[model samples]
Target: MPTPNPAALEFLLTRRSRPWRTLCLPAPDRDALHPLLTAAARTPDHGKLEPWRFIVLERPALDAMAQMVADRGGVTGVEPEKLSKSQAEYATSPLAVVVVAAPKPSEKIPQMEQHYSAGAVCLALLNAALAAGWGANWLSGWPSRDPEITAWLGLSETESIAGIIHIGTESAIPPDRPRPDLGKLTTWFTP
Candidate 1:
């Protein structure tokens, strides 16, 4: 017989990401965020590579990133509308954690698996924040993917942004979006 934690199961079933735009002030301070980061660090890593790191961005850093997006957008020929949206993503958020996928060289484990591990960390952080009573959203836009922007953020040549998780107080409860139908997506195999 297996023991089941009903509360944990319920939380998994009902978890929903709040929109970054809907998040307000009173974001978790460093002391409060420590546990969430610790929880995120517990993500499964194949071969014990630990190929990921986190960068917490406060208002000033975010503002600088916002300016960088605005300035670099013109050089990169990004459309105005897309540039504005990306800029707002950095400018408005009270606090965000950038999950960087820094893959380590491994003869046994592939780079793709390392990347997946970093992405898992992002989800873990997001879920942890939500479970801790904070509104959270995972975001990655053109700025996060752009080499120039990433370099400014101190990403090495081997590192890339897995996600930027924005965390803050919930201003509104967003209507739940449609979820995937497991029956249509799942396939049971029998021999």
Candidate 2:
């Protein structure tokens, strides 16, 4: 018989992402963050191709990236409000993990699967941080989709930002948002 972990189930049921704006200082240090990263790395990879990597961005790096976002936004003629939001996301975060989707060459595995795996890694990392008693939120803005930002972050041509997971202490707990109705979303098939 498989061992049932009620606590784990309870956690999953109640897990809620803290708002990025609500995240404050006292973020996890390198030593504290290492295990969370390790846990994230354990996410499923269909072809055993680790199609993702994490870039731990500290305060200074975040500030630099925020500037880059603003500069890139200017060059791209992005709307001022959008640009400001993007800049704030980077500048205000105490710590962030950029989950890059670096798909590997594979004849058998589809590129879509690799992309899905990368997304999984992002969620895994977010969950890991949350489980470790840190507030975390996965964010991807215009910068995440822009080639200039990718180049600034030192990603190869094929690698893209799957997510930018902001991690820190929660200054305020956000009220729970409405969840999907599983009954409505689910479909049971019988033959």
Candidate 3:
């Protein structure tokens, strides 16, 4: 018989993402992040296609990204008023992981499957953070889609940034927002 983990299940049911703005310092160190990466690797991938890769944004990389974002923001037509605020997100975050979707073309595996795998990895990483007692959020900023920015992050031609998972201590607990009504959304198949 498979061992059931009720605690994990219950936690998943009640879990909430700590708002990115409310996340602060005390992020995971290299030794501490291994398990989280391992958990994220367990995400569902059709055809065994490992369609995602992670760019662990340590201090230096984060700083570079922050500056690059600010510069790129200027070129991308981001309003002058919001540019600094946008760059500050990277500079201030304790830790950030860029989930890149590298969709290798395959005759057997469809592109959609690769995209799905990438998305699953993001959720898995988020869950790992929550389970690890850290506040986390999955985000994809404007810089994610920029070719020049992606090149700096070492993405192949086919790869794109799927999400930027930020993990840190919670500065404030956000109120529970309303959720979509599942009863009204789901279709009954009993008939």
Candidate 4:
């Protein structure tokens, strides 16, 4: 029989992501964040391709990214409200890690599998931060898909942002929202 870990299971059931706007200062330093990154690196990868990399964005980098969003929005004719929302994501974040999906050329592993691995990495990073007692939220907006923003962040043609995980101290724990009805979503298949 496999040993059961109730605590870990309970945590998985109750884990909730804090709101990005509510995250405060005193974000994890490099020394503190290293372990989270290490944990994130342990995500499942088919063919061991490791098709993801993290870009840590501190306050200064966030500031620059905010400006880039604004500039890109203006040039691309994006709506002002939408632009402001995207800009605020970077401008107000205390700390953020961009998970870049960098697919490798491989005949054995499909590109879609590599993309899935990158997405798993993003979730792993978010979970690691939350488990380490940090408030964390995953976000991806229009800016993440923008070509100009991708270039600015140094992502190559074969790479894109899987997620932007913002981390910091939690000011308040928001109420849990409604969860999916498992019975409605699940289907039993008997052959």
lDDT (CA) per prediction = 0.95, 0.93, 0.90, 0.95
**Candidate 1 wrong stretches, greater than 4 Å:** none
Pairs clashing within candidate 1: none
Candidate 1 has a TM-score of: 0.98
Residue pairs clashing in model 4 are: none
lDDT of 3 by residue, 1-191 (tens): 99999999999988999987888888999988999999999999888879999999988999999999988998889987778876888988889999999887799999988998999999999999999999999988678888889999999898898899999999998899999999999997895
lDDT per residue for candidate 2 within 1-191, as digits (tens), equals 99999998898999999999999899999999999999999999998999999899999999999999999999999999999998999899999999999999999989999999999999888999999999999999889999988988899998999999999999998898999999999999998
Regions more than 4 Å wrong, model 3 = 1-4
Per-model TM-score versus the true fold: 0.98, 0.97, 0.93, 0.98
Model 4 per-residue lDDT at 132: 97
Predicted candidate 1 versus true structure: per-residue lDDT over 68-181, tens digit per residue: 999999899999999998888889998999999999999999999999999999999999999999999999988888999899999999999999999999999999899999
Per-model C-alpha RMSD = 0.8, 0.9, 1.7, 0.7
What digit string (tens of lDDT, one per residue) describes model 4 on residues 60-115? Answer: 99999999999999999999999998899889999999999999999999999999
**Candidate 2 Cα outliers beyond 4 Å, as residue runs:** none
* Residue 190 accuracy (lDDT) in model 2: 90
